[model samples]
Target: MSQLQVSASPHIHNGSSTPTIMRDVVIALVPAIIASGIIFGPRALLLIAVTVAACVISEYLSRKILKRSNSIRDLTAVITGILLALNLPVSLPLWMAALGGVIAIVIVKQFFGGIGQNFVNPAIAARIILLMSFASQMSDWVVPFEYSQRIDVTTTATYLSGAESSLPSLIDMFLGVRSGSLGETCGLALLLGGAYLIFRKVISPLIPTVFIGTVALLSFLLGGNPLYHVLAGGLLLGAIFMATDYTTSPVTRNGKIIFAVGCGVITVAIRFFAALPEGVSYAILLMNILVPLIENLTIPKTFGREVKQREN
Candidate 1:
């Protein structure tokens, strides 16, 4: 009746595809992007557009030059662009932002075999590169509309960088009326997006939950304000978005928890003592590099065997 067909190991097809998942991630980012526009002004839109275009172009050109199939349709480049734009200051020059996109796509993503083969998140790695290359531009913060009346300047310090007494109220930070990176400023918007991902089953809740909980719990035990730690800077954005990247994170449930906890610990240590104010980028990047190790250590046991016995 029917002929037998041969295929790869993942013969069972799921409804999900690369483009679909990337589309969902883009949808989840919309609220944060809109919130950035409201708080940071029209320039936010320009930066986003610039970076997105740059990334798409870079991906297309890289594929052509490498004689590889064009992967732009998959939208991983698009997500990387959006993430990079959100991490940058609105005041950054368009060219610098575009350059960051190129680095992300060319040096990081494609060079490492593209997509899932990369050892780190392209956007996070690009942000760190940009930060190192343009520290002054990267750290420059624009005053949000809500804070316009209080501050008579174009630029101000971020929450972690500012004096402890002058930090925005927990409410203001939560609502995203404070000054910071375009996307990371709005806690409510990020949470909304994060919840959407969790609802759609695009991402597991375990990594985000453990990552954020570890940060809060550790902060409290170390005499730091837990709420402020959770709401401030890019902690929420990183924990939910960047830290949970499937290619860069652990697969097993136990491995994911360990990866997340490691991220939290590094993040807290950096924020508390490092010269830089925010540590999400580096923390997530470092954990991404160690994901293989984490997975190896936390591999699940056979169904009928003891955990230790399975390992042996």
Candidate 2:
């Protein structure tokens, strides 16, 4: 008789690894990176490089100090770095950008146990921390080259910042000739990146579709320009990338919908009623905290388990 051998769960392997998945994510983000470099100039690339270096170094040092296995090889630190940089202004001080990267890797990621163990997305957490700590600096938006010809100003308010008098046309917004963060300005690049991720199967479209759909529907119902809302600020970037982080988002289909709808509602509320003009980061952070609850409620019952009926 053959010897009986039983091991741990996840016996079936689909041949996907953390590094492989992260590589795909990096590939998807390349277009956005190129667009940022083109729109924001060489300084944008420099900031991204600085943040990426900072995150990589921070992860290396933190892991060494903590006596934990090195995880930078997994490429998560790189992704975190890129995402954090994209969330920042191109003119932000390099030191501040480096500090944000350190906070993301050392505090947000490693302090919590690293990688999939993190409670919230490290980039989102870092961006929020920087925004709260340096409100003025974070709010400074740079006008792209194409838009500079139309306006005589170097800096301008974001489209969602209630500067209605200077709002760009929908075509310009879609083409990324506006004032915003490094990567959030270009809706076209973000959409292309999102499509790549979806095609590569790196992420599911459920969360992004539901999240953007909810926002559009709510904006339309609330007498706001649905297209403008969809194209403005960091909505596309957040919906496509940050909000869909696997560790911070729900796993079940129904749970994803609930989480996305919640994000949309909170985003609209903050944008329309609260003082904050941009709410994507906050919306995602709030929903990340509720992922555990969402998963608990949505997980399916075990196969072959007997159903229990409640007593009348």
Candidate 3:
């Protein structure tokens, strides 16, 4: 006779390790990276390299100091770097980009017990911090390649911040021929990457589809251009990449729907009524804080537990 061993409940191996998942996300982001290069020129690539290096070095140093096993191999830090860079203006100084990476990997991520334990999305939080701290640099979006000149001040106003009539055609915005953040400008590239993630089963379509649909419906109701709203700003990037984060997003299907809708509503409200032209990042951050409450309300009850108690 052999004694039985009692252990934790996650007894099955799904074979989806953290490194593998992060790698898949990295692969999915390639199209957006290429689009950024085409739209923003070589500076975009340099910024990405600096930010990624900063994140990797920050994670290594933090873990070494904290006496924890190194986490760079997991590649969460790489994802953080990429996402942070994408959210930033291409003209931002590499040093500032590096600072944002440190804040993301060290403060927001590792200090809070690292990846899975983070309260909000690390990249989003870091980007918001950089935006608040360095408003001028963060807002300095260069004109798109098609209309750019060899000017001293390369910065120009984003289309979303100006009147609708003053903006580029929906086609230009969709094709990423206008000025905006490196990642958020290219709707077509983002959709391609997002589709790959969905096909790879790396992410579900529910949150993104519902989130975008909600935004579209709200824009229509509010007499705004639904297509423009969907194609412009950071809506697609946030909905597809940041909002669907596993640790920060809800686990239940109903919870995900509610979370997505809540993000969409807040985003539309901010865009329509507030001073900010775009609200996807803030909306996702706010919704991420409420994920726990949403999960509690939506998590399914165990089978027969309620019935057994009622019979007793």
Candidate 4:
């Protein structure tokens, strides 16, 4: 007779590996990358390259020093690098961008036991850190394509900065003609990337739908322009990508709904009442921290486990 063997949970196989899933995510992000390059020029691509190189090298060095198996091949570091870059302003200094990458990989990711064990999304955390540490550079928004033209005015303010008198048209906002972060400017590209992820089964539409719906409804109720609120900041980017991180988001359907709703509510509250112009990153980070408790409350009970009484 053949010997019996035992293994961990997840006995079933889905035939999807970490590298394959990360590859799909990278593919989905390509449209956003292209849009950012067009809107912000070649400097945008150079920033991405610098940040990615920083993240990859940091991961390699950290793993070597820690005596752990190398995980750079899994491509989580690459995704982290790209997401971090997307959240940053195009005019941000390259050294600062590289510093954010190191913080994402070495501190937030590997420090917490690497990929699956991270408490929050590394890219989001690093972006927040950079925003706090280098407020001026992080908030500096340069006019798109200004490097090519001899324009007297090169700096511009984001739509969310209470510049209603100079707001861009909805068409321009959707087509990446606005002043904002590298990736968050283009609603069209983000939606395309999000759709690809949903179609490829790389992510579920549940979190994004609930999060955006909640924000839009609240914004309408509060006498704000719902469409503008949805498109002005990082709401779409966070809802579709960062908020849906597998390790940081809830596992059960009900838990996901609760998590997303919480994120939306907090985001709207901050945007409406708080001093900050944007709230998506903080909302997602707070919700990521609560995922464990949400999962505990929402996880389904095993079959037949609650029906029997034991005798001592």
- Model 2 TM: 0.92
- When summed lDDT is taken over every stretch of 10 residues in candidate 4, the lowest stretch is 149-158
lDDT of 4: 0.89
- lDDT against true structure, model 1: 0.88
TM-score of predicted structure 1: 0.90
TM-score of candidate 4 versus the correct structure, residues matched by position: 0.93
Model 1, runs deviating above 4 Å: 1-12, 146-158, 161-164, 303-312
lDDT of 3 by residue, 1-312 (tens): 999998998888788998999999999899989999999998888899889999999999999999999889999999989989999888898899999999998999999998799989999999989988998788777877843542233333345443687778989989998878889889999999999999989999999999999999998898888888898888999999999899999989999999999999998898888876478989999999999999999999887665434564
Q: What would the TM-scores of all predictions be?
A: 0.90, 0.92, 0.92, 0.93
Q: Each prediction's Cα lDDT score?
A: 0.88, 0.88, 0.88, 0.89
Task: Compose the digit string of candidate 2's lDDT tens values, residues 214-273.
Answer: 989998888788888899878999999999998999999999999999999999888877
Q: After superposition, how far is residue 192 of candidate 3 from its true place, in Å?
A: 0.8
Pick the lDDT winner: 4
